[model samples]
Target: MAGDTKEGVTLELVTGSAEIFGTDLQLNKKYTFPSGTRTAVFTYQGCTLELIGPTVHAYVSNNTPMAIFANTHAGLEDICRDTENGEASRGFVVLVVGPTDVGKSTLCRILCNYAVRKGRSPIFVDLDVGQNCLTVPGSISAAIVDQLADPVHGFQLEQQISYCFGSTTPTANMPLYELLIRKMAENTAEWMKRSRNACISGMIINTCGYITGEGYKTLLTIAESFEADLVICLEHERLYMDLNRDLPNFVKTLRFPKSSGIEDRSQNVRSYGREAMVQRYFYGTRALPLKPYRIEVPFESVEICQLGAEKLPDSCLPFGVSADDHHTKVVYMKPDMKLQHHLMAVSTAKLISPEVLNHNVFGYVVILEVDLQNHTFALLSPVNELPSKVLIYTEVVFMDDQINL
Candidate 1:
């Protein structure tokens, strides 16, 4: 069963057993799904649910790709068992790829949940910057999936490492996107060495839906960087064939049809989701609200760096060289009124340089107010103090209700 709740909805398992994103629902207990939530309930055995409240649409269908999902999980489990038995030297890594709205994220969630339920801990790497499950939009993040994800809240944020590409799409800066993916892969490798369970259980990667031109190249980069053992392509036969032809023989590729319940969202709906995600970062959720601190910092105290090369006219370029020569240029900027309402990443780097692009961020802050006269800016941050002296500027902007700084 799948539905879109409008003004929130309540679900009760009337008979049999069922699960949402791999978490079992309690019998006779009510589960409240928040408004604007798109979800589906799955069960191997036939079950009945009583739903209450308004919804955009609701439906029940026996046709689902859940059996394929379960079989894939079983195959991964066998690989893990092989590693544990000393038949393999390292854990297996699975990469899920496909176009947008193809249920790639859903498959990833189901796989992670199944792994956790079987006493395994798999690392979840989210490369989809447009709608990341592990962190806010415009970033690539990874987290250890040690428990089943909540149906409403999704994955729990713990020990998550993220790098802000400063844009929702990789098309903004392909070099920066690829750079972050490499850094994430290196970090994940080191993390796996520390935990035997994590190493044996392996990692599951979720990528963006962009599957043409530069997007295709980005997928290859991710596969090679992470040394992915298996590539699962959903609903895109062309992509599957291209990857099989281009990728090395050591890597196996499989294609699966997309779920019938998948729905394509419009640009406006996607933008709304991104804005809501940013708000949730600082404000928490309805169930657990958080108080974000607003602090005024001197402009001279920290350095702000922006990624991307400076655009120059073709006439100024030498010979056949193009403007895309310097894709990783780090330009420093002074605070001004234009910075207001934009999000800035608090870099782990102590100084502004090109190396900052390779480092993971401490967190993010919104520029609430920029005072040119006082040479100080007001920031709305989740923490009281900025952890680093360097900040990276991003193209993502957020505007909340007006507040006195």
Candidate 2:
């Protein structure tokens, strides 16, 4: 797994009693051999590994060969292209934002992985006040403050920014993304000073999905602060585009919602098929002919009631809910249940965008049989803000249980 600098020459050490050399034997050179080497071999390295030995013994070790692109300076050039206009010390700043289950943290993990793989320490910062997946679950500020208080800790802090709210003190009403620009700059500067690693030159900030007018404002503020090089809007970007009438196929490729129950329908009951219809009704694109399951009731009783409806259509029960308003407005799940469930808010929140339904911390949707004894419902999203009350009716179906009409 190591690389060599000399073109067309490969160097490798053998663990067994064999010594091999690519160069000619020199009297002045020390012919160091493995302690237990009873044989010697030679090999050539190029696009592939070739083993040449005196005795024929071939075993590939079952190590799967990974396709790795050769390292090129083009990547550095691409990274620098965004920062060329900025100060020499300050590199490009990239921001990553998404909904609760859209894999914001996962994206951060990928970025960190890429950075570490490149022998760099990417200054990471988590601004998800809801889930704080990178930080402590509930204690967002504490987790971040503790890290800053002790930077030399044995724990390998994910080269991240504050994982909690930026404000040091909690207030009844504070500005969204408060202290973000200042904190990001301060912490990044601190890390740069402490660790003189050139790779620690860039910054990445992860944001919460619960972007209120205030939250969105905060995001724009931070972007302005850094004059960011790139803004990677994650999950919500698609929904936003669709609402704004500029949907991209890259976004439409996401899974739609589905029905939550149908495995126990009566012989004449075609609930799953009907749920599929509802999914098609809303999405009207490439919906599958199946329903997604009702995973969980992520919303609190108050939240559910506030949704303004408790019953869905007779056909799309437990998965689709229509507004009582005269608009015949309907909300339904995406066709791919598993993918939607994996990446979206469960149950009712499936219809809502992640930006409006940040439930990773305070609450989230869960799916399970309604009356099944001792069955557990899993959390689907993080609760970041209180939901607005809209006139809506919703219903979910379980094997033997039912929601009242």
Candidate 3:
């Protein structure tokens, strides 16, 4: 039988026939053997036959790394009945990566809750240091992690995840991300031994903030170290890794982005190495602008501003200038009646120039939009240029209810 190498399942031919006292043999491995079984037990590949009747001859052959097993007439029902041994071999390890406050901790909690509901326990590690968001003193209890295991239900292994916080350094490039991942894996492996009947089934490593350059490399290294089964990237679009491209190490990936809230916005900016004032600049720069334009979207509107690589027209843009150009600042003004708040959109294209575009002196722009309803703002894009339609919509005014000519 053939199985995934990562699954750690091996095919061993034991000293038994296809049927022993009416019990049939089965293999849930990925590949199947072609040869049929006979009355006498035979061995194939590295599998050995240890006969229990009289003379037990153990066969040990060195076969191919993943060769086809061409021996076995196990019944179809028996073959089908062999369930996937997800719990047998090395358990699954999942790594969650994304910008801060994007529900990484919340999702971890949910997963733990899910494991608990299924009578299984899960460990949680809070590595985010800037905000002790995960390790809020009384948030986690050791008693809960210890109780789920029992003699009757068998030891469903669950460990209280370890935290490696405060070691992350802004100067060291990628502060301890690799170290933290390695430590968690090693520690979980150690904990697995204590369980009476069960072993560590899986591990979840939650990452912090927008990882780039060294940090990104460090994250990849961590995933590889743990032989990660799944890599969950939250709000990955903002990370700019061209996630559409296939990654090497991780078997599967999941992307989930939470809506931007005030707390989320604050955390996102802080994670980008920006000071509070710079964050304020990107968010509340224009407390009062000289002249601002307006655009209106009714409650029916859902998707706003789907952008592309089109240069905006000068006339349709705010401040009578192209939003993509360094000299322009697109500020939107809305009356506090229907929407009950004012919205301001600003571009830091001129102030920082190439710095805003990470020193890529090309036609890059930093477009920031702020919704005043809940004091939430977003640094939307740092791309080639502004979209033509978006520029037009920015300058147009909403009269009565609809945008007017």
lDDT of predicted model 2: 0.34
Per-residue CA lDDT of candidate 3, range 320-404, in tens? 5545442222223232232221111222223322222111111111223345574432222222223211211121111212112
Query: What ranking emerges by lDDT with the best candidate at the front?
Result: 1, 3, 2
Error of 2 at 320 (Å): 52
Off by over 4 Å in 3: 1-90, 132-177, 193-201, 238-246, 259-405
Which window of ten consecutive residues has the lowest lDDT sum in model 3? 64-73
Candidate 1 vs candidate 2: which has greater lDDT? 1
Which order, best to worst by TM-score? 1, 3, 2
Better of 1 and 3 by lDDT: 1
lDDT of 1: 0.87
Once superposed on the true structure, which residue ranges of model 1 sit more than 4 Å away at CA? 1-6, 313-325, 402-405
Candidate models: Cα lDDT each: 0.87, 0.34, 0.34
Greater TM-score among 2 and 3 belongs to: 3
lDDT of 3: 0.34
TM-score of 1: 0.94
Who is ahead in lDDT, 2 or 3?
Answer: 3
In candidate 2, what residue range of length 10 has the lowest lDDT sum?
Answer: 145-154
The predictions' CA RMSDs to the true structure, in order, are 2.3, 19.6, 23.2
Better of 1 and 3 by TM-score: 1
lDDT string for model 2 (7-106, tens) is 2222233332211211222222223221111222322231222332222233332221111111211243345443444435444456665444454444
Task: Report how far off residue 6 is in candidate 2 (Å).
Answer: 53
